[model samples]
Target: MQKSLHITPDKCTGCLQCEMACSYENYQVFNTSLSRIKVFDFHHTGKKVPYTCTQCDEAWCLHACPVEAITMDKTNGVKVVSEDTCVGCKVCTIACPFGTVNYVQETGKVQKCDLCGGDPACATACPTGAITFIDSNWTGLDKMKQWAEKLSNQAHA
Candidate 1:
């Protein structure tokens, strides 16, 4: 049963707690820039969407790595980058269409979300339940359930 991070952008408050938690868990620091998860703020619409690696089934980053630095974690279906193997070529960064994979200047390597070893800190740190760690097979279950409830209410009315 693989799990995944489900993000509800509408529930996010742009608090940046997820970034702080992710950085602290991975790098032992509270730097948002160091965090793998990034919150994109749309000033015009006043919307903030927390974005990270989706761990694609056919990951382009994993395929683009010349050194084979990126590999899939079978346990959680996450694409993990090995810093030791990474040559900082930035090929994976370009291959990823989502632009989730980023090059870290300090380490001279690419970094992205690895689901924090199957227990995502960003999801846990989210105060408003905007980020949730859930079963990958049913990521849309919540939305479906919500719509079902609404329909049920309409039927009752």
Candidate 2:
């Protein structure tokens, strides 16, 4: 019954509503820079991709935190930071391979997606169907990998 944010790059319009919603929900501000989610614009492809923490099983950030500040919610599979315990060492930032972990100068702490306590503002604010909270199995990544691998095999054969 665990759900996660699924993003479709082609459906995004670069409107940044997700960013605004996320910042406002967590920080009471509308600044995109303060948002946990980010919309990246690709000029060549004319695509806007919204990216955030995947909350992967490994959770490098949680393991990398020297102060043991990052913890995973077993029920929802979201990795969260404990601001009180975080020492602002920036080690977790470097450990995150996806570069989603960011340091906040104002708070002197690193921040990333927490799924907004199981109701993500980013998914709710997406004007298009680009971002959705769906059953984790329906993310389509496995399906895409299966088809892509077939294409790769056919090309090689």
Candidate 3:
């Protein structure tokens, strides 16, 4: 059962607790800029959506690495970067479509979510339960159920 983080944008409160937790866990600081997970705020609509690496099964970052610095962790299904092996090529950063993988100037290395080794701090820190560690296979189930309910209501009407 592979695990993944499910984010409900509608439930997000824009509190940035996930950002703080991610930065603190990786950098030991509260700097949101250093956080791998980012919350995009839409001022006009007052909506916020936390975004991060989806840890794709066929990860472009892993394939793009020149030195084989990025490897998949079998346990949690995450592509983790090896700092010692990384040469700061930034190729992996460019390959990622979601723009989750980023280069850090302080370390001259790329960084992204590693599921915190199975105990994701971001999901734990999300006050509104916007982020949840869940079975990867069922990620779309919630959305499907919601749409099914709407269709059922329309059928009865």
Candidate 4:
């Protein structure tokens, strides 16, 4: 049963708990700037969307790495970067369309979400249930259920 991070942007309160948790889990710090998962704030629309590596099947980062540093975790399909193998060329960063993969000056290596080795700290720390670890096959089911509930309510009214 492969699982993935399921984000509900509408439910995100912009509290940045996810960012803190991510940084703490990976870096032993509570800095948002060091966090792998970034929460994008759309102030005008009051929408806070947390974005990170989606662990694409055909990951550009993995393909762009010259040192063969990036590899897919077969267990959960997460793209993981090998710090020892990474040359810090930043080709993977440029190739990543979402800008999720990032370089760390301290380590001279790129980092991204590896789903916290199968139990995502961001999802665990989300206060509003905005970030969920769920079955990858049913990622869209929550949205479908939400729309169905709205339709049923409208019909009743």
lDDT measured at residue 23 in model 1 versus the true structure, 0 to 100? 98
Q: What is the per-residue lDDT of model 3 for residues 11-47, given as tens digits with 9 covering 90 to 100?
A: 9999999999999998899999999899999999999
- In order of appearance, the predictions have TM-scores of 0.92, 0.88, 0.93, 0.91
Per-residue CA lDDT of model 4 for 84-127, tens digit only, reads 89999999999999999999999999999999999999999999
> What does candidate 3 score on TM?
0.93
Query: How many clashing residue pairs appear in each of the predictions shown?
Result: 0, 0, 0, 0
Window of ten residues with lowest summed lDDT in model 4? 134-143
Q: Give the alpha-carbon lDDT of every model.
A: 0.95, 0.93, 0.93, 0.94
On TM-score, the candidate that comes out on top is 3
Candidate 4 at residue 122, lDDT? Answer: 100
lDDT of 2 by residue, 1-157 (tens): 8888999998999999999999999999999999999999888988889999998889999999989999988888889999999989999999999999999999999999999998999999998989999998775788899999999999999
TM-score preference between candidates 1 and 4, better one: 1
Candidate 1 backbone collisions, by pair: none
**Which one wins by TM-score: 1 or 2?**
1
The TM-score of predicted model 1 comes to 0.92
The sequence of per-residue lDDT tens digits that candidate 1 reaches over residues 1-157 is 9988999999999999999999999999999999999999999999999999999998999999999999987777889999999999999999999999999999999999999988899999999999999888984777899999999999999
